[model samples]
Target chain A: MNTLSYGLLSLLSHSPLSGYDLTLRIQPFWPAKHSQIYPLLSQMEKDEQVTFETVAQSDKPDKKVYSITDKGIDSLREWLSEPASAPVLRDELMLKAYCVPLVDPSITRDLFQSRLEYYRNNLQRYEEKIRKIKETSDLDEGEVPAYRDPLFGAYILLNKALMSCRTNIEWCEWVLSAIPQDHT
Target chain B: MNTLSYGLLSLLSHSPLSGYDLTLRIQPFWPAKHSQIYPLLSQMEKDEQVTFETVAQSDKPDKKVYSITDKGIDSLREWLSEPASAPVLRDELMLKAYCVPLVDPSITRDLFQSRLEYYRNNLQRYEEKIRKIKETSDLDEGEVPAYRDPLFGAYILLNKALMSCRTNIEWCEWVLSAIPQDHT
Candidate 1:
């Protein structure tokens, strides 16, 4: 399963946060929907992993200020201690890669060229996001936020993911060139 | 869905094949069980993608000899021409990479180390398969059997994935050293 729940815990471990804070800040990394959110929040509450107090806002939507319980802290701590699983490489690209050179070398070459462009676009996005963050935020080296910042981990994740996209593009280009260029 | 069906077309594009030959020769790259085999075979026949006729065996099990239809070739051609889907990278290792700095630093370090080892193992498996192919067949580079030949593309994919893993390990090690290096 997609580990949004774990993402929720990671958020709360930084500090008590509202559902709104989670939706804006953490959602960028984990990418959850309200459907996954409300249910997970209720389940976490039922499990006594978190407690939320209803907060009213004068100008905008009211919010639930959710705080990690002692149990939640322990859970996050345990999760942090446990070993991570192996990479689950479910690459549809691999399917395409296999089909090509056999079906029509011309088509395969064109497909790979397009994919290279896609990666280049992604790399641009990652670089832009990094630049924007650097200009806007006061992040120190490795960004050790003062005992209450989910953004720290998010920043690290973004950097790593960006590197991955760069590496992917580089690899894809190398592979594209290595295969004999066949237009037909 | 797992696109093992492509392997069948790839094989048949080269020549007619029996069901047993499919199970034996084609199953290794894109794996399937007996349960999945007959159903997909039947579906292909109804779709007029493949023609199957029973062939009696003198001493072995009777087999359905399957040949690609003209329509099948056209379908395969169209499939090759269509834009391939973007790679669906369900990388649990990447999530784990996010988890690493959040998780115990030492455990995270150990995990990457193990991952590095696993990648090497996979590379060895690929190498071993390639060697076995060479030993068993007199097939030259251009004359290689379609499904049986080593896909240089697959090698590049594996190579890229491994390089990413190695780079990740290096990054993890650097970060781990920079950190307090006290936690396990």
Candidate 2:
């Protein structure tokens, strides 16, 4: 099965949600486009992994809300137990760092400074989200029960991301200093 | 221009090399399949960004050694000055971390421990290569030159990779501790 399918199932396991809702909810974990999510939802429905019901509404168009099936939950649990594959870090800045000696030192300094800004902003955003999640009770946020709450899982993810940004900034500063000033 | 194309030019800027040789040289930065490299070489030659000359050898079949054109060098420098794009970190482990509360904690703990091992091995391998690179001078291993050397760029890349792997193993250990023992 596709990884995205499991992500959708995992989201539905929390609560029944529309395709649009799924698109927004999954962004923090997996930033997939809506175009990708809608088609996958239909495919999962055909495969009997997920089922959708059209909920009538007076103000908006009828929405097809999706929920995970028993098969989907079983599949998710199986996947969760299996080893997680390593990600290919197609990092462009790291790629640039590989070519920095060919360029002006000032260019690299600027790039590092910009990245420091970018990751600082990213780190701040994740920390704010983590704080918000913690402030709300499990019931208020529609979380899985405290025993099975996915927020705990999300917390671990956010914590790692926060740490990664911190590491990046530190490395960038190191690179800047390592390059000779007279070289520029 | 394709990122891979610039990577090829950057490699050629160091010295003229055959397609297979280029594949080996570029592996430390961007690992490309031989299939991908050969076709891109042909395409780049047609674009006037690269040119090749066939050299016959007494012991072996003729080999086409590729060198970057002036146009290619200009293109590479232009690209070097441009802002780097953010890579999509499609990290599956982080994705798994987002759902860990749904599975047995022992499974995640085991996965994290295994990952710690994997990255620790990776860090050691890169560190060894870095040490080897530092100890050797020209003729010891054919280096470009002290002036136009790519080793400086490569050193930065290796340092970052080493730090990244270290960070990953540390994070894995932290995750193992963060998960409550009773969760299993």
Candidate 3:
């Protein structure tokens, strides 16, 4: 199985989640579309890595909720033992940033301004999530969850997201400041 | 044309480059394989967005050095005016991080330790490049290049890379600290 398949199994290891819930939960870590995820989930079930139950919903159509099997946990342990592949980041803004000399200074300013807003919004969301996690968990101020705790993984991941988001926001503001206020 | 197509054009706007050079230069911003890049260059040439000339080398086989056409510049300008699509970051380590509690603490420590090494290597490379840029460009200490300068884009992009790398390194160290020293 590919990294995404292993990623799906990783999420299921925490708790059984519907495919929709899995889709939402996996976004910040690994962005995969529904089309890609559904087929992978089906293949995983066939391989006995994961098993799903048809959960009936009153207002919506039935959904498949998947849980990791023993086989899945074994696969995850194997995958974890291997070195993870390098991160791949494809940002259209970076490409644009490379050619900023071709555009107006105002256009350049707008590009970074909007990106600043994007990061700010994400910062707010991540902060809210981390605060919620703190409220729910027994974590003390400046204290991390124990390695075996269920919240340990989520705690660290949220911290990474927050750190990265704030870094991007800072970079965007720096870029904006560098741009001239008016086209000369 | 896809975003990669525009990305290639964006790079060409700075200077003409061979497909091999393009593949190498784009790696820091958009990681693409030689197989993927050569085919895209051919397609871009067919669409008249770029033109190429065979440059013979004494030690190596002749290569096609591509230069952006007026059409390519127009395309890049159009792309720059539009808001960039959201960045896509697919990091396998993050997936593994989300399931860290499943593995031994030692295993988790190894994962972060290796990632820390990776970021350190990158940090060194970026630091060296930024140093070279500073030495070559007319930029003063803590001064940014003008928007119209050829080095402006590279300058900002490198700063972003450095900032992001340092942040990641900080994160890995923090995670490693959080993990217990001895398995309980």
Candidate 4:
């Protein structure tokens, strides 16, 4: 889903928005670096999907507020209507684990153990975030926001995804302990 | 996860086998064609992670069987004991879909719809395969095979994956319906 491009169009459809506003709106799902942002923006302008107007700001430099063109609207509408392909799953770490017999034993062991720790830390962080979010003010976007909180379904997915991560961590531990180890 | 490569090495650790046998065992999770397979095999050989010997056969052409080296075993054992890395996801179709606003509207629509249809067909095929395999007399071997009978946990995952596909399909339809007819 040319996600970034789609995002630009989506935001513009609602209202003309600055790059900063678009960045914030898109961040929850479509992550983008400023580096990726500028190039794609330039590309979209060249393609006539979007045009920018200089907006005077009270502070800081003049901002470029982007609006979607008719062509852009047609494109996103077309995309939104289309079915997505099956997601491609590619985990290079799993592949490397499969080839563990080929590399240095200690290096592999160290790497795996480090990953285990990392996963633990990751789980901790997510737990903290989810807990904080759940405990804090209501998911109701003050009863009437332009967009409904994506969290309704997003949290459900987070549960499943988190469960999967925990399973992966357990699996990692299981494989580590069960496998016979002989340094010599 | 470099899963195929890692699996190939561990599989070799068990005993030397040809690419055909390896592919057959590996496909349930790590499906790879000759193009993807042979190239990686060549690279592993170059790295001395695997050793291969060509053997003559009576009723068939000669076969090249591969085996894991002692160093490979050490590496595998070490890797299993360590923690794994954070998984990174890369979905090309999603990326393309996200950027659809930059492409020609009709072209984007066609591509998106094609992908949707492809996913739907895959869902059907997986469902059928599950049913047929259940009706069959015997189950095969490997990690996924162990869960073949009477809707195992692995089967549950396949089902879950299927559900996700169906959900995505609905999302696509919703997106389609939301768009104006002129875009169509």
Query: What C-alpha lDDT, on a 0 to 100 scale, does residue A19 get in candidate 4?
Result: 81
Q: What lDDT does candidate 2 reach at residue B24? A: 88
Model 1, residue B96: distance off in Å is 4.8
- Rank ordering of all candidates by lDDT, starting from the highest: 3, 2, 1, 4
* Per-model TM-score of chain B: 0.59, 0.81, 0.98, 0.56
| Candidates 3 and 4 compared by DockQ, better number | 3
Model 3: how far is B37 from its true place, Å?
1.2
Mark the regions of model 2 whose C-alpha exceeds 4 Å error after superposition: A25-29, A54-63, A137-148, A180-183, B24-31, B54-63, B137-149, B180-183
Order the candidates by DockQ, highest first.
3, 2, 1, 4
The RMSD of every model to the true structure, in order and in angstroms, is: 5.8, 4.8, 1.0, 8.5
Question: Lowest lDDT 10-mer window, candidate 3 chain A?
Answer: A136-145
Model 3: CA > 4 A from native: none
Per-candidate DockQ values are 0.29, 0.43, 0.89, 0.15
Residue B86 lDDT, candidate 1, scale 0-100: 60
Candidate 4 lDDT over residue span A1-184, tens digit each: 3666776676576568888777775553455666777678778989999999999988888889888899888877666665554454544455455445444446555666776787788678667766665666344532211112323223433443455457657655754553335552
lDDT of each: 0.64, 0.77, 0.93, 0.59
Worst lDDT 10-window in candidate 4 chain A:
A141-150
Which lDDT tens digits does candidate 2 get at residues B25-135?
A: 787566788999999999999999999999998998888999999998888888889887765566667767766777777887777887888898898999898777777
Supply fnat for every model shown.
0.33, 0.54, 0.89, 0.16
True contacts kept of 4: 0.16
Give the CA lDDT, 0 to 100, for residue B46 in model 2.
Answer: 97
- Score candidate 3 by DockQ: 0.89
